[model samples]
Target chain A: MIRQFGLPEALAILSGVQATILLSLIAFVGGGVVGLAVALMRTSERTWLQRCAGFYIDFFQGTPLLMQLFLVFYGLPVLGYKVNPWIAVAIGFTLHASAFLGEIWRGSIQAVPRGQTEAAYALGLSYASRMRNVVLPQAMRISVAPTVGFMVQLIKGTSLAAIIGFVELSRAAQIIASATYKPLLAYGCAAIVYFVLCFPLSRLSMRLEKRFAVKT
Target chain B: MTYQFDFSVLLPYWEQLLRGCWLTILLSAISISAGLTIGILTALAKRSRFTTARIAAGTYVEIIRNTPFLVQVFFIFFGLPALGISFQPWSAAILALSLNCGAFSAEVIRGGIDAIARGQYEAGTALGLKPLQIFRHIVLKPALRIIFPALSGQFVLTLLTTSIVSSISAEELTSIAQSIDTLTFRSFEIYIVATILYLTMSFGFATLFKLIDRVYFSYPVK
Candidate 1:
């Protein structure tokens, strides 16, 4: 029996894997920054700000990421904003990733010893200085493991970006699969690529979990 | 920047939006309940005395965990049709959601069971309690308590995952919102409103879970 699928098609598909990686990175960095802000706001003293952040996190975290993508990708254009598909996907994912990451990071932040914050305060460090100099460094140790674990999720999440017309790995797989009528092979290859991308991060997360077990 | 928000466009379509919300809730409730049941079975199977049962369940969890749920839904909705399963969008959505939730729930429940002290099981045997009775009275209670937080967290995740059903043309809240957006040409307002409604639902679940935890656990939450 002759094999119909060739290396060239697989190579072409694999070459486009960078788009998925880019989506994941953009979502990771964008989500990380927004998530940190949300985490801080969640712990803020002001009631309204905390409530707002809490609501934002809850909204993104609660609803389906697919729905969020639909709402952002289709919903925004209807509202007269008329943004590009990439921007919509990025925004949708960033918001979705932010909620989960914010909660995770907040857990890490709260896990920091109260005495550390108290000591920093006693030393007359301003709030920003205390957070930057004394608290975040320690919190990062606690945050690293889970944060790395979440990167796997972000990478997988880029698959949703394809729904909004972004030709990422999953979407590209769909395109080639339909053109070639070998879904099992095409999708299988895509999954393997995703697995290959995510497996290393999973291992890294486990390593971090072991190395930083004390902080957590 | 004189963009005034007009919510009045949504007033005429409130009835449809409400129906969509109803569908969303119904779908979520069904998926979560069914997923929880399947999850328990799978969780137990994964840790069963027989290796084959354990491997079968373990494989189910791993495949579901690793693959994208969107792909799983497609396999059911589109792929199953090729095999003449003939599932409606709702049924397919429920199936996918249940499988996804079951995998996650199995892990949570397994963690709960694993966290149990070995001595506790020995003590049950020493008391002449049968395995079923021991599991029912001792293992089930503490495991539920331990896993409740994670289970609730998974439910929240499931709630969001249900939105993917829209891709199959299921008229859930997001689908309805899309229709409403097309009809009214008020995407920002409708989406903003839908966003708030979703937040309300999330808050509602959180509050309900907290109350249930208080009433059910009563003891200290570990």
Candidate 2:
């Protein structure tokens, strides 16, 4: 028997917002940490480090996220590590996020005026202190808009975990849709929920971009 | 680790993989062209004098931009059927991809158009050009030149996104890899191959776009 598309069904799908948010948060924070290192590496003086970082960014950016998730989901087992969908999806998203964030930040870092770096060097600041005190703060300011923009992508991307059977919002909708035989209502509700979640961030990104564009 | 990596098992399925890649290219090509058309029209509509047209186009861009493509695909492929508007998987995939691409490229194209100086339009008017002629001669080319890199980048993204249509049972590389995985139980190997194929295709397209940029957009306009 097909279940009616009722409030209860809607609530069940809405419940998935938590997992989606959690996954996006985890990926963002994790990716941010690794991505910083990547950005630093890309901007570093060492050519080898830069090349390695470049290759990492290129590899991740060039391939599809689904394939990345599949690799982790399936490849982990062959290496004798027990894997669950959550672990696999988390790893995949983190790696994917790192590369993208890294590239974004690398540009921001380079965009910091060359004169500032020269002044930092002339002031006897160490490389670490120069970057920590002089460069990163400025780069962070320039990066806020794009980073937030990327957050919108990250949130939408969390929906892909559904394909790997991760029980996120999209998967939840799939369950409800299949059960209720009301695919239209189920998917439509899911789309609205996603819009509710994403539209604000998109606006904020654009606003931040405008604000920064004027100041810079 | 006792498991032996056996990529050899996938060797027999190379032809299927090739076919999958071809279909993916075909899907992306059709969607990109359709999307560019939709994008140009929507971008123009958004900038039109009529408030209704502007609002309608704005709303379409926002709705598509804010939602995930997968949900869009699901809505189009499965949900539409409930309303007696069913489509073949391939048709649904193309429609969803084009719509998604259209929304994104509309923004890009609008930005391009907006970047053209107001004087350029006035200059066209002073030259006795019709409005359509003004847009074609004065606005469109420069705007396209400015946005070409971004547009091509979006196209590459659309190419990558075609993989997601597999969920609706649209025949593509990811779907083919999934089928091969079922047949050979070599999920890792199959996916790795698929990933490499995707990487190559994206890189190839990026290179091709760069070449187009150099050949067509390189000339300095007087």
Off by over 4 Å in 2: none
lDDT of each: 0.81, 0.94
TM-score per candidate: 0.88, 0.98
| Model 2: lDDT of residue B101 | 94
First chain of candidate 2, TM-score: 0.98
> DockQ, per-model, please?
0.37, 0.88
Alpha-carbon shift of residue A118 in model 2 (angstroms): 1.1
Highest lDDT model number: 2
**Highest-scoring model, DockQ:** 2
True contacts recovered per prediction: 0.25, 0.89
Clashing pairs in 2: none
RMSD of 2: 1.0
lDDT of 2 at A194: 94
Identify the runs in model 1 with alpha carbons over 4 angstroms from their true place.
A1-13, A45-49, A74-82, A214-216, B2-4, B80-86, B220-222
Report the CAPRI category for model 2: high
Q: Write model 2 residue lDDT over B1-222, tens digit each, in one string.
A: 798889999999999999999999999999999999999999999999999999999999999988889999999999999989999999999999999999999999999999999999999999999999999878888899999999999999999999999999999999999999999998988999999999999999899999988888878754
